[model samples]
Target: MSNELYTVIPDGSVTTPRGFRAGGLHCGLKKTGRNDLGAVVSDVPAAAAGVYTTNVFQAAPLHVTRESIGKEGKLQVMIVNSGNANACTGEQGMEDARSMRDAAARAFGVAPHLVGVTSTGVIGELLPMDKVLSGIERLPAAVSGTREGSEEFCQAILTTDLVKKEACVSLTVDGIEVHIAGAAKGSGMIHPNMATMLGFITTDAAIDAEALQSLLREATEVSFNMITVDGDTSTNDMVVAMANGLAGNEPLHPGHADWPRFAQAFVYICRELAKSIARDGEGATKLIEVQVEGAVSDEAARVIAKTVIGSSLVKSAAFGADANWGRIIAAIGRAGQPVNPDTVDIRIGEIVTLQQSRPVPFDEEQATEYLKGDTVEIHIHLHQGDGRATAWGCDLTYEYVRINAAYRT
Candidate 1:
């Protein structure tokens, strides 16, 4: 949690890490001329770890990625396409996903088992393989080990997102400078069980595949898994991480001396990316953060925090700049977490609207003004234990409705 161990790289991206190159291109996946296909290629086989959506109708690309990474716990190239979610297309979809993987392998000169693939956009439709394969053929030429390449790749993964989400940091591990960077995109259908949307993390640290997998899973629990937008988990949500071990440091694990610093930086990057996704929620005007403390356990606190932040009533209230403590309390109650009603406290910014579950008359105008800001913070104290957690969301607004009403068109 301390900033002393790492430095934030200004305008950093996936290519910021050593031995990584990224790029994106337009392949006619979308009606507009925006880049719809992208790739992040590691110079060598990199230890890989991934977490995918829990939605039953998982995308075909997710299965392909899992097979590639599960074989040897490493990946050399990761291909992604936007504007087509490659889900629910039956056996043809499976074949298409493998075809994409094969194309990426051939283009990048890597084994098919060393390449992973992902897709996002419209669901339940077959991908236009003609265009997708053409994009894959030209993909290698588009890639470069530069910031511009990373930027382009980020842009290509976006669907309804208004802005790209990325985070990068450098920390010293075993006296070697290690860099870690991530890029993500998600504006809607973002309630995550493991992870939301398409996220990619690249690091140059020397970490074992098992250790990296464990660390990434832990980070997702408190970061991506804690945020919600519309409470609809997509069919093609996943976060994939590759560690190229180009830092030339000692192998990292739980017992490594600098593991704490590395883990801290990793979790920080994920949380920042997740918060960006929440802030950029489809047509959202304001970012709302809910902090729940003193629950029976950390899991309980997480559930309560997510419940409060995900509630439509709470989001609507935030959009209207209303000090609606009742909605917050109602959410907390339904969270199914143990809460001593009489000892619960609630606050919107510094305005205390509820104290020990008793109404505290506060200046409604001040509360409204605070909620009207670009960011809102809600604090709930249960006085039950030491467990605490935080969740992020965005206010419900008319623009959100208008954007989703005709999203497919």
Candidate 2:
């Protein structure tokens, strides 16, 4: 009923929420027999919302998914596959995306318009519908509203992701217990102005479709949109969420009394998942958090934070524990935001390396020691206003280059 509503279940996943079931299986999409096809279905019609990549050239599956969501605000299923992006394959690709949804709907006992489909991995490849449909036919039996079911689906959706990613939290609305959960995948091509990231969230809190869309956009601004793996955003970026009203809670809207608590928990899960994706950036060794504060406005702070975290120089320096403060300051200067040259300050962890735009006489050994840790925090203050923002990335290394160079080979 209040902001202090729910607790986090350590072993929770997308299926932790009520009314949801998920499963995945191998269908020869990947070179090996790893599960590459997956689906998540709700027991009832659920309100749905999606945010997608802003790239000029869109993917076929994205178009199909959009049509499904546009037909009705409610959805019951999402079919996803890894190893074949099905992007830019022309008209056949669009039909294949739609066909996958229809096949999945029939297999799951739902309407085709109530199903959405997404694909990831190699672009410009046509989806092998025969194998994908075969996988869908068997999904109903494998899918269940259990942790194992969610875990299997998680693996099926991954491409370069090193490990499964999921987050869940519990909350109460109108005295009714509600659960929210999410899962995502991205290891490279992840500069989320949306990312190559594909995120799916399921919840049992009855929320209005319009309200859900607004909430997702606002939360993404500070979560998914604040993460960077590399400078490139992928062709298949998307995050969709479904809310089934099985929790018996009062409907949530912008004006709902418990909307704040629900939104807080929702954003927390998104941020955790975002951080996880950043930490797992291809061949990354350490997580990097860039915090920008005291800017002229929140938007300015966000730009500065993102620019700093997305800097290759800064990332490489962190990888080597170089303690190169000049790279950090140079990044700030080139962020294209108005900053008082004499009012800037910077720090790595707790070690102050720059003060008021001047080099702070500091111990190189201390700075190197701080950067040697598994997580690095870069803090900057402009001393101009109260605005603040945080962005996440990872330490760039030689392994990153090696992995990406041979990514397709």
Candidate 3:
């Protein structure tokens, strides 16, 4: 997606931006020896923005992060942990979250409100503060502006995820070069309206908190909010972004001449991260994409696309390499959106399985072969209007049930 206005950094991460450093270390949270605690810090206060899970039972760390960022619209450091969600533990959970923030602030020599904290993992468990504070005390010593540090940070924030999700891009902002990078961790308990994921973005662009917040929300609607692995939403989903104004570009706003370019690059990074999460879904062997076109509105198209991608029948059919157009059309019909049944068309790859709302007699062998690939695309045309949308998910397999059935054990 790189072009004249922007370029992609092949090897980029959260620490790729100016004035930032990150690292991670083991904290006895996970059963394995992998690092379970991490922190990303900036040399100076940076403008901050965040979008959180809409679940009524929000996690404790989310409240702590929101309070810190809402205080002054800035943050100097973000502390995170995995393997313990610290949710449904009542007041004790909130105290532990704030304690995590205070410990990071004390270690980094920053004010408490300038530190943000978040956590993920098994719900209804109390965080072991002894291990967490010890990890925080040693966190700063591990911090550095290097790829190794970024990789450690990424590794520390995983549970069921098999691969690290990261993206970076650069765009020119008024003759100044600005870089944006992000890292995310998510595998299951994923669906629209956010998922069981934690995303962090860093940039060197000079932007205010208000403008950055608006841009983050808009980008999320088309990226993170359009993907699902399972139909369950989690309590700890959050995406936060920070800009340190180190790029030396003029302050950016919605009216800036190059704002659109920067936004494009930002949205691209976010979409890449979101797609990676979908591709790496728990026990998933293939990624499934649903593209809807010619709807009454973009929102309607999005609804139809999500419905198709989230259908268990559709996912199972893809997993079995079956060209089941019936499941696809069934999902579209139940999406509760406007659609002209007589003018509908559906295709699996280049093979048209249905046209004008009727069977088209496609090659079963060819269609099955296409579905067996690592990625599959389902194209649907409503022929009702100019609206369009794309959604991503993954094929369901027996392995998925096996993994989740004994996850807590």
Which residue pairs show collisions in model 3?
Answer: none
Off by over 4 Å in 3: none
lDDT of 3 by residue, 27-96 (tens): 8999899999999999999999999999999999999999999999999999999999998889999999
Candidate 3 weakest ten by summed lDDT: 1-10
What's the TM-score of each model vs. the native?
A: 0.99, 0.98, 0.99
- Judged by lDDT against the true structure, how good is candidate 1? 0.94
Q: How high is the CA lDDT of each candidate model?
A: 0.94, 0.90, 0.94
Total backbone clashes of candidate 2, pairs 3 or more residues apart or in separate chains: 1
Local error of candidate 3 at residue 158 (angstroms) = 0.6
Model 2 C-alpha lDDT per residue in residues 42-120, reported as the tens digit of each score: 9998999998988767788898888998898888999899999998899999889988988888888888889998999
Ranking by TM-score: 3, 1, 2
The Cα error of candidate 3 at residue 186, in Å, is 0.3
Q: Please provide, for model 1 over 1-409, each residue's C-alpha lDDT reduced to its tens digit, 9 standing for 90 to 100.
A: 2379799987889999999999999999998999999999999999999998998989999999999999999999999999999998999999999999999999999999999999999988899999999999999999999989998999899999999999999999999899999999998987858434888999999899999999999999999999999999888989999999999999999999999999999999999999999999988999999999999999999999999999999999999999989999999999998999899999999999999899999998888899999999999999999999999999999999999999887
